[model samples]
Target: MSFKALIVDKDDEGKTSAGVQTIDESRLPEGDVTVAVEYSTVNYKDGLCLGSGGGLVKTYPHVPGIDFAGTVEASDDPRYTPGDKVVLTGWRVGEIWWGGYAQKARVKADWLVPLPDGLTTRDAMAVGTAGFTAMLAVMALEDHGLKPGDGPVLVTGAAGGVGSVATAILAHLGHEVAAVTGRPETADYLTGLGASRIVAREEINETVKRPLEAETWAGCVDAVGGAMLARVLGQMKYGASVAAVGLAGGAGLPATVVPFLLRGVNLLGIDSVMRPHDDRLRAWGRIARDLPMDKLADMIQPATLADLPELGRAILKGGVRGRVVVDVNA
Candidate 1:
């Protein structure tokens, strides 16, 4: 059988291009199960893989969707049978292997998780890797003793995917959410997602001379690293933790560790990729229960496989808002 996919290929001239291509099932890489992909999503990593590899792509003719939801078309593994709904993220499937930006995907059974009972394939893709990572960040903060009444939780990059989901989930859990965004235009949108206050990016993006500032946030889910994260550290309430999720601002941390040493602040690093199967199951189950479907609906902007190239560029430029759910078969 044959299917259509968005393929990113590099030419001998060293330029790369992405477009739709027809491919045969025989071309799929080794795996225990074959999935009829229903939906995929564009992430910051997808933006990199779609353009110049971002050092994440190890081979050419790659399909760059890092997260996907689908139904099993065929399977040799006893754990999954044909027609089983599944979701996949991480394990470097999109970067080093053929991924879900296609009508079909073949992957190891271990890389697949049964779609949680409350989520459809489209719903699963709507959550994607971004939302999954947000859930993990929230879980980490909660495990470290964060509670709704403790103090306001800050969400940096509040209009983006991870931040948007984090804001919604935290607010749903009864925490007061303070959203930080560079785009003033997204203030209403962020508030609609449950943020009680909007903090301008300028308000917190720079480094301060004082190593320890006034303690503010009870907890934080930081998607913008670099200086923003450094500054946020100084504002965390005593013994509070900030879950570090992304480096949208930059990778370097140019601040002192005064908050950690003097105030007992904690910076938790979140990695969705290579997460254990048990953790994956736990996160997805929590997402199904905690993340409201209505709010998820508000955060989504729909797309198809053909829109990926432009969306990829948009994400790289930080122009995309919320989650972009890609219908692979659309």
Candidate 2:
């Protein structure tokens, strides 16, 4: 069967090019289940894989979508059968294996999760990998003893996909949310997502030469790392923890150990790719119950396969303001 896909291929001069292409089902990689992709999503990783950045994709002519949701078209594995609604995120499928920026996908049955109730395939993709990661971060923060009564939780890069969802979820959990963003225009957007306060990016992106700073945040869900992480670490409340989820700012951690040693602050590293199955299920279940779907619909921006190239570049530039749910069939 012929299908349309967003295929990225680089040239000999290291110039990268990407666009939609027509390919055959026979070209799909070996897997136990095949899905007719209704929706995929754009994340920072997908942006990188679609372009020449991210350092995640090591191959050429790749399909760069880290999250997808649809119905199984066929399955050789007993775990799934044709017409089962399913979703996938992480497990490095979009990076190392062929992924879901297309009309169809064949992936290991182990990577598939039956779509949680109260979520359509489009809704699932709207949450996508970024939203899933945000959920994981929220869970990690709570597991670290954070509560809504624990003072204001900070969400860095609040306008971005992961940060936006984190802000909404934290606020939904009854936490006072402080959304940090460079763009002043997103204040209303963040507030609509339940943020009680909006913090300017310049306030927190300072060089962390100080081992400690005046404590401002009770806890943090950080999507921007590098100096932001270092700066936020110093500003966290004593005995507070930060869930470090992304490196949109930068990867280098120019941090001191004073927060850990003196303040008892915790920096929890979060990885969504290799998450254990049970944890994934629990997170999805919680998301279905806790995430405000009405608010989520307000934040979703739809795209098609043809929009991937521009969307990829926009995400890298930090221009994307909300979750982008790509309709592969569109």
Candidate 3:
């Protein structure tokens, strides 16, 4: 069968272009399962893959959605069968393989997870890789003894995909959420997502003046790395942990170990890609139960395959708000 897809290709000179194209099923890579993709999502990585490759896309003429939700249309694996709802995230599928930016995707059964009961395919895409990573970060914090009454939890990049979901989930879990955003216009939006206070990005975007500053945040889910993460590390309350989810600001860690030594601060690195199957299932299960459906609905801004080019650039520039659910069949 022929299907529609956002095909990203690079020319001989290495210039890249992305546009909607009709793709044949025969062009799909090897896999045991073929999914009729319902929904995909835009992430920072998608922005990269859609544009210059960000070193994530190795092959040209690629389809660049990192996460997708769909129903199995065909399968050789005993783990999944036709008509089963499933979700795919991580394992570098979009970067290295033809991904869910198409109406269909064929992937290894190991990369698929049964869609948790409460989440529809669209809802799963609403969570996507970004929200899935946020959930993993939250789980890490909880495993490290974080609790609602412990104190305020900070979410950097609060208007972006991961941060927005993190803010909502943290708030719903009864924690005081302090959301940090550079966009002043998103303060109301962040608050609506359950942030108790909006911390301006300027307040924490700089490098740490002192290795040990005020013991502010009880815990944090940091999407902005580099200096902001360095600063947050210093400000974490004694024995508190910060789950490092992304490097939106920059990758370098200009930090000191004083927070670790003096306050016993923990910097937990979260890797969403290549996560174990059991853990993926656990996180998705937790998301269905903990993340509020209404709030997830509020975060959604729907798009189609045709909107990808602009939305891709928007996400990389941090201009895209909340989750962008892309209907592959739209």
Please, what is the whole-model Cα lDDT of each candidate in the order they appear? 0.94, 0.90, 0.94
Best of the candidates, TM-score? 1
Q: How far is candidate 3 from the true structure (C-alpha RMSD, Å)?
A: 0.8
Q: Rank the candidates by TM-score, best first.
A: 1, 3, 2
TM-score of each: 0.99, 0.97, 0.98
Which should have the higher lDDT, number 1 or number 2? 1
**Compared with the true structure, what per-residue lDDT tens digits does model 3 show for residues 109-223?**
9999999998999999999998999999999999999999999999998898999999989999999999999999999899999999999999999985689888999999999
Model 1, range 1-330, lDDT digits (tens) per residue?
999999999999978999999999898999999999999999999998899989999889888889999999999999999999999999998899989899999999999999999899998888999999999999999999998899999999999999999999999999999999999999999999999999999999999998888989999999999999999999999999999999989999998979999999999999999999999999999999999889988888999989999999999999999999999888
Candidate 1 runs further than 4 Å off: none
Comparing 2 with 3 on TM-score, the higher-scoring candidate is: 3
Query: lDDT tens string, model 2, 1-330?
Result: 899999988899988899999999898889999999999989888888988846788888788788899999999999898889999999998898889899999999989888988889998988988889899999999998998798999999889888989998999999999999999998999999999999999988977568898988889999989998999999899999999998878889999899999999999999999898888899899889889988897689999999999999998888788899898987
Candidate 1, number of clashes = 0
Question: Compared to the true structure, candidate 2 yields what TM-score?
Answer: 0.97
Clashes of 3: 0
Where is model 3 poorest over a 10-residue stretch in terms of lDDT? 206-215
Model 1 has an lDDT value of 0.94
